[model samples]
Target: MNYINKITLLFLLSISVSFAQEKLSKEDAINLALENNYGIKIADSNLKIAKNNKSILNSGYLPTLTGNAGATYNKDNTEAIFANNEVSILKGAKSNRFNASLNLNYTLFDGLGRLYNYKQLKEQYNLTELQARETIEKTLLQLFTVYYKVALLTENVALLTQSLKISKDRLTRVNYQFEYGQNTKLFILNAEVDVNNDSIALLNTNQLLLNAKRDLYVVLGKKENPNFYVDTQVNFLTKLNKQELFGQVKTNNVSLLQIQRGIEISSFQLKANKSGYLPTIGLTTTYGWSKSNNNSASFLLESTNTGLSTGFNFKWDLFNSGRTRTQIQNAKINYDIQQLSKQQKELEITRDFNNAWEEYKTKLFIFQTQEKNVETNKRNFSRTEEQFKLGQITSIEFRQAQVNLLNAQSNLNSAKYDAKNTELKLLQLTGDLLNTEF
Candidate 1:
């Protein structure tokens, strides 16, 4: 067995090993991210907290009930002189008292502040939901970016592997021709140099492939490098319409929705602040009982009392040193800020969508052009190979054709993945990424 045969055998063994590793599909990768990614988990927890906050209790709609009880004991010696010139002396005087009360208070009105607060909480919950979704959209975008990158590198490695095989074959032919006195030592040296160059390229690409796979593992929340292979097929959505995408962006963009929710929340805050100017009316009810016992008393040694009372209370903040006025003013200003922010965000999203749309179109076009270029290079390399075997073409020309074919294939691979990434971005901008079937 020769050196080339050994190299080929080793390459085949490695390929077989790679094939034995588990194939992680794109859908599986996405599902794993959703299930286990830390960012997604944190977002989900925050969303749950927001959901839990949306309750009447948090809005102050419920009444407050409280109970109190106490007991006291006293011991003392007393000497008392009566008005009839009689002296009465009492020793070891003892007294005990017990008291208990239950009080209930309910706010009947506060300029509808409770209602506005509840609405605010609802809006906050909605905002949190949108924020979580945005997190998901961003995470999915990152995932796909890395996923396609791995795919590109995977295909590049394959192409380099094939290129290396061609170089090695050319070197073997050169060696045979040199042994038969048909080729010069310079030709054999050139062929050997090309083989080494191809080997280096393949090694470097394999390293990139490894690093990309590691990134994929991290995104999937895997603690270890699983050394798994990814599906190189990147699916692209080519029929996306600009007008339809813009429509979706206006209505469904997560960031836009969050801003709209912020506007509503600010509106509620303004209303709540305005409520502070009006009188607060409430109902209060109380039930009480008390008992007392005294030893060494002539007449009224024991006493007990019980009572129930109910009343309505009203309080108007006639003036708070302009505090309420200041709060209302601030709330109004915040509401205006939110409105302006919404407008700005709308413009920004529209611009991003436009850029991504144009990029997708351009990348797709480049991909098509590269596809044709690769086919042409492949045919040209085939004819060059035949001519070189017939001694009609120089080794340098043959090497140039080989390099051209390799580069064309590499460019095609890169363009394909780049176009796919742009497509994903468009989907994300339109809020259709999560809903679109992969």
Candidate 2:
């Protein structure tokens, strides 16, 4: 009674756990990644930096003010002469003074460096945003892969377990017959071996499930949050065919957007470099006060006053050892590299679409064919067992029949999973996997 109660309790607990595991949805996974993924964090930090740079770039357009203060003491020993050239004895004297002034500086111009820098920063902002999207897509891809793998493994373990139960029932019947001297012992041994193998497979599957769960935590960016359970509700998105998959890749693929942003950034860099050749002009202003003490009577000798002035300045780089030309060349080279990368990416995407399409077709065929194979094998195994009971088939033959049935079932499961994975991959390749309908 105690063993039976414990078993029942364990079964109930397992069911509750499964229900809990299934509660996580795809949207939950995406939101978790966006909030916690390391890549997304880095991208967000870069965006902050770009915004700060943009703000600093505009500072040159504003005026700057400064204040100053000082205190000094001076000692002098000298003789004073009368108007008639009569000399008198000299004495040492010290004078103390205090002074302060305020000055302001404003840029008249700097060859438009400020404007170009601002433009560059703006472009960088776009790049950082694209980078964030890239991280998001990559994170999503990893989540999809791990989640489906876990789901497939879980289903497989369940199927195999059901198979083991059926095999166990057959073994029990065979044992009953053997006690009556109506069945061979070899049949029992074979069943035992098969059950042992199935147990081993189940153990391995469980380990894999654990590993997949750990990966899920990583993809969700929750290394420190162990108590957070994942939602594993999954559905194979259907209604996607090769016909419409590729059509969306160019428009919706995050990688393609990043490539386009790269192009825009390179264009802006080129423009910035070209602007260096032109002269920069700007306006400036300075206001301050001054005073001087040149004699012992410092309080009587002074020129204390304040004034304000405004003027413009121009700077032209006439000769710079071809630095501007070199910079322009560098910019052009970077542009060429980006363009080439875009072309290469296009080709790679095309190849991916073609491969995914062919794979989808292959899996579909296998899925259809395996269904018939499972049905046929099911009948064959059952008939072979009846023949063994009548002493018409050898134990070896019956064991082979069992193996065939198991293999068929395994293959059929594999085919189903393959079909699902290929279909999802094809949609992703065509850049429409995450569309609202899917």
Q: Each model's TM-score, in the order given?
A: 0.94, 0.81
Clashing pairs in 2: 24-231, 108-281, 108-282, 108-283, 109-281, 109-282, 111-280, 245-430
lDDT of candidate model 2 versus the reference: 0.71
- The sequence of per-residue lDDT tens digits that candidate 1 reaches over residues 293-363 is 97664456899999999999999999989998999999999999999999999889888999999999999
Off by over 4 Å in 1: 1-13, 81-92, 297-299
TM-score for model 2? 0.81
**Top lDDT model:** 1
lDDT of each: 0.89, 0.71
Evaluated against the true structure, the overall lDDT of model 1 is 0.89
**Which candidate has the highest TM-score of all?**
1
Compose the digit string of candidate 2's lDDT tens values, residues 259-328.
Answer: 8778877877887788779887756566666665656433366556577877777878887899998999
